[model samples]
Target: MDPGTNVLDLSQLRRSCSSCALSELCLPAGIGNDDLERLDTAVRDKRTLDRGGMLYRDGDPFEALYVVRSGSLKTFVLDDSGDVQILGFHLPGEIIGFDALASNQHVSQAEALERSSICELPYARLQQVTSEVPALHRQLMRVISREVIEEHRHLVMMGRQQAQEQLAIFLKSLADRYQRLQRDSTALTLSMSRYDIANYLGLVVETVSRLFSRLEEMGVLEVNRKSVRICRPDLLAELCRSSGVPASKRRDAG
Candidate 1:
């Protein structure tokens, strides 16, 4: 996962990945063979980001739309006080840098949560391909729509939820995302640290630690270091939705 030397040749990777699990997610499904070939040719390079490495920083000149090939990335922004707030986590098969399509400048910073690989598709080339391929245009529209929905969900999570509810919902959402990617859903490993989770959830680190202890006591989760095992998914969801349970009682339930 050396960022410098692990760069992949675009053409070879695309040819080897024709039947990859991410094919439908990355390329427009049902595209003509010729168009797929064109796309394969348009892609320029693949780059790796080592753990804790910055992929791009805010205000950086955007060059290409990046597609996550493996591992994970987190996008975040720093407030005036220099506090970082995580905006979203990008998993394998997800697209990063799509927001650059409109602004032409990176609005947020993206960093590797783990050793990660990303395929860089030059923006100019992508625009050219999309202009000729109607299906690709439609697919890009779909991707934008999904981002809108995801942003809305995050907004709600941040604006309305309590500390415990936020932690529950966050873990559940991560599990669901992993499940969608066909990864182990029950055992969740956090790439981000406690401080990152706290910032993302809009809580203090001490509160996050307390919430983890509370959940473990309630029999809903088992946490060790950064790894969590969901023991009672249904009960956890119920707790997230219920306001009747006393905080102490809820802690005991788990």
Candidate 2:
């Protein structure tokens, strides 16, 4: 948890992370062992962020691209009207600050939604490593491609989906992500608050609360304070497609 501490042992870190649930999505699929080791060396810090902590703010110097080792993060932007628009949520094994790679300043703010750990790879060092490690460059390309795809999905969700439909798709998406981490996909503990969800969904808190009640009453979800269980995933998916709710809205609803 200490930013100053060497929280990861290099040899063990490489071995442990190589088999991590996210490895297939993260590392270069066909990377050689030596390249993997080189990539590991680029990681400079393993820092822990507590709930409500700011990982980095807009205009903060872009130093490193962080990989979520555990827990969840929310990225958002504040408008001139003082309203916060949630951009996206990052889960374990996902990369943060990818947008910064193309610009000198960060495009948005990243904050911890729960106690989280991230591995930081200094940008300059990573660039240097990539120059010498072809596999690393390929891996970086894949990461960027994934980001683009996710962004495209968000844009579609925002433009097309309705509130209830969006919420259903969001729950299913979160459940899929949890399943990847070997967690229970049906039941989830929400680290982000209802107010945050409302802001992200572009709805009032009352609307968000009402949606939860409606879904619960319909036997589609089991809702508790900051916790949820999807009782009918198939039905939820149908709602997402039929209602055309934005994915971000659904994700925030729970």
Candidate 3:
């Protein structure tokens, strides 16, 4: 795919909803054969992005919604100083590019943090098909709402400056997403870079590493490079909750 067109070739697109593993993540249930076929047609392309490759850059014209079928992506915006401020890291079964739905232009760049495949749903065609398939429209709306809620959760989580609170919540969020995908939540690999994680959490890379060591010392988790094993999720959650409170407030309440 050329950077100019930013389009995937048609023949490479996966054209089946019935057998797709991620169908339940983004597709409506009880869909008839006709509606399923319509969905297959609506998502006319599947794009591939190599690690460090961008799905779309900021200011690009938004043409479609991208659903991650495999691997991970990071969405980031450039500050006035041109520093990257990571907005979010996306996992399998998640959708990106919705932030541009109103403006018809990308507000952030979505890049693959690993080799990834994404199903591209053409927004124009999707609108037409969803009008005929009310369930599909409802599913899209539900997905949008869920994104909003998740973003809100992240906003609150990041408001805390303590490494314990920030990293514990971040780990828990990843575990929850893995559980949703029926993958092992206890043991997992974080494909995103430490730098990206630091940027997203408003911390330095060294701080991120230090927090991981602290978590290991607490026996809450074990970290091996990008690999992580949650040894005590309950304890981790407790730390996330308590560490976020101001020290003076905690003392007064105590």
Candidate 4:
């Protein structure tokens, strides 16, 4: 074996998935160690976005999916009325740009809520790796599926759930996502501001503030500025489960 070839392989080996803290959340459970190297190779670029930076703008040509290696982002669109419509929030271990895969052009803009690192998975390379690795393909599908499910959850929240229920579901969902990344689920910092949350949840800023105050009074949670501590997750869960939207209605909408 050539010594130079051995050295190059060692360099690639050092970039394996085990080095990523969010690997367990991003990759499927059964991926082979060898597949991790393939993934690392497919990740062609690492880009940093400062707070308020746009990852990709509406109508930008999209040739890759970006995974949030660190930081947070919000995907939004400007409606015909020139109003900003919040789509969703992205956290570490979550992948964005899946929407652009269908049309090859982004319909919404992804903006960083804070300074963040992103891993770019070029479409061509991702397809090549997915073709070679069944687990990789499945993992990508699962991530896309979760995004779809989350969208539906948001729709249900807005369409029928009360303001309190909507807030509960949102908080509970955020907690669950953080837990998946091995973070403290009960304690979290809101990267997206209150204004953004209100926009996304279809509530006015004052209404959002009132609802948070109500929840705090209920002793279900504590909120100080952007820091949230879930004092009673059980109570929060109950509120989410009792969302005014019935199961039959959800199924029919689907």
Candidate 5:
């Protein structure tokens, strides 16, 4: 009954899944309150990561899954030439570490794009709780499905689209994600570097820079360094569609 122990417990309770702001967008979505409390117990650790910190490296053991409570992260792998090939950027409320599930080891590295807070759920405990909570299991599948869809979208963009359409699809996808978070969809800050962006989009750095300038001139976007404001979202959407990329299907978490 120590007073300091009681205070620490209260602090942790405030960060529990039931009290988290991203509950609806995260694993707690569509679960009963009782189930949320159970899931919260499974999330054993909440940690802070500084910018450029590596959460996991290629071929590392995957002991737990991480949920981004704040800030952003990028996942990438090294090419045969030892060059970094960017995979994807992860925003707040998204999950990472699924890549390890298939082989029980991570094949890519995840690094923090900024100082961030993350919640960790150990795999064994998560499996135990999900088996007892059908709703939680269903929600987990939905999150994983979204990740698969995004990968397919990226592959299509890289293989078929021109540079302009590729950039358009990337921006439009970010705007959609922002909108889902109930944030301003038209404005976005690029958390990853231009070189990383170029790598992810399969374009050179110069081409990425020139496209930003070209989009600005066309009034489709207003770019100031890493900050971008989609001045004409309609035009941006049109560009995405013009390349024959299928329209994005908005999946509901609930």
Candidate 6:
């Protein structure tokens, strides 16, 4: 299907909660057949966004949670100086909109980094469905917990690691995430620009550009514009370890 704004009817689509490849990583995980059907029904709409399209702005009402069905998105906020501070990048099977859960309004903006398809789960219906499905509720809790852990890990990485170590950990973490999704862990097509990557890593754009070239020189990565092939993830991991980052938290450092 072409990527556009029309809302997709899940009933007519080939992909749904039960049939989705991302079922194990998303809310549908651990749900029973009947509960899955109910949870699927709670997904009221699926929408497409063009690259650079705004999914939701900061302060928008928290009405639904979005699950990336295809493509990627980046969430960010404007700092006091009005500079954009990237919070995270969302890949397929990853959920966004959790930023609104606490305040009932989004604190950051989510924008499509590429043509993307997203499933919208209305929060009210989700709460009702989760109330009835114990397994689903547990899964939701687990997902939220993981989000918290990821944020904490990112904070630690930013504060403790040097520039090269930060970049290495970030690439290594992205590779690991792809591997978890059953994709090639060594290759990646970065949807977010170098500027976004720099902002997320708390570095200047030039620093990020220089670091990529450095990694390429070290034979740890093969960088071709936005495309990157991790030639030595082991070397990347070692960089993180040498920076005193624990092995267990290395995968989530990005």
On a 0 to 100 scale, what is the lDDT of residue 202 in model 5? 92
> How would the candidate models be sorted by lDDT, starting from the highest?
5, 4, 6, 3, 1, 2
lDDT of 6 by residue, 45-96 (tens): 6799999999999889999998899999999999788889889998998888
- Output the lDDT of residue 82, model 2: 69
**Cα lDDT of model 3 by residue, 4-69, tens digit:** 697765453445766688877878778898898788878865778899999999899989998999
Runs of candidate 3 exceeding 4 Å displacement: 1-14, 244-254
Question: For model 4, what is the error of residue 235's alpha carbon versus the real structure, in angstroms, after optimal superposition?
Answer: 1.1
TM-score of each: 0.86, 0.84, 0.89, 0.89, 0.91, 0.89
State how far residue 210 of model 4 sits from its true place (Å).
1.0
Task: Give the total clashing residue pairs for model 3.
Answer: 0
Off by over 4 Å in 1: 1-17, 243-254
RMSD to the hidden true structure, all candidates: 6.2, 7.1, 7.1, 5.6, 6.3, 7.0
- Say which prediction, candidate 2 or candidate 3, comes out ahead on TM-score: 3
Write candidate 1's Cα lDDT for 88-202 as tens digits.
Answer: 9988878788666677899899999999988777888888989989998898788778778888878877875578877877888888888978888889999888988888888
Error of 5 at 19 (Å): 0.9
Instruction: Give candidate 6 regions above 4 Å deviation.
Output: 1-10, 13-15, 27-30, 244-254
Candidate 4 residue runs with Cα over 4 Å from true position: 1-15, 243-254
Judge candidate 2 at residue 254 and give its lDDT: 62
Q: In model 5, where do residues sit more than 4 Å from their true spots?
A: 1-8, 28-30, 243-254
Q: Model 6 scores what on Cα lDDT? A: 0.86
Q: Which window of ten consecutive residues has the lowest lDDT sum in model 5?
A: 245-254
Write model 2 residue lDDT over 4-76, tens digit each, in one string: 6966665566445465567776777687778776776777557889998999998888889989988999999
Q: Which stretches of candidate 2 lie over 4 Å from their true place?
A: 1-21, 244-254
TM-score of model 4 (CA atoms): 0.89
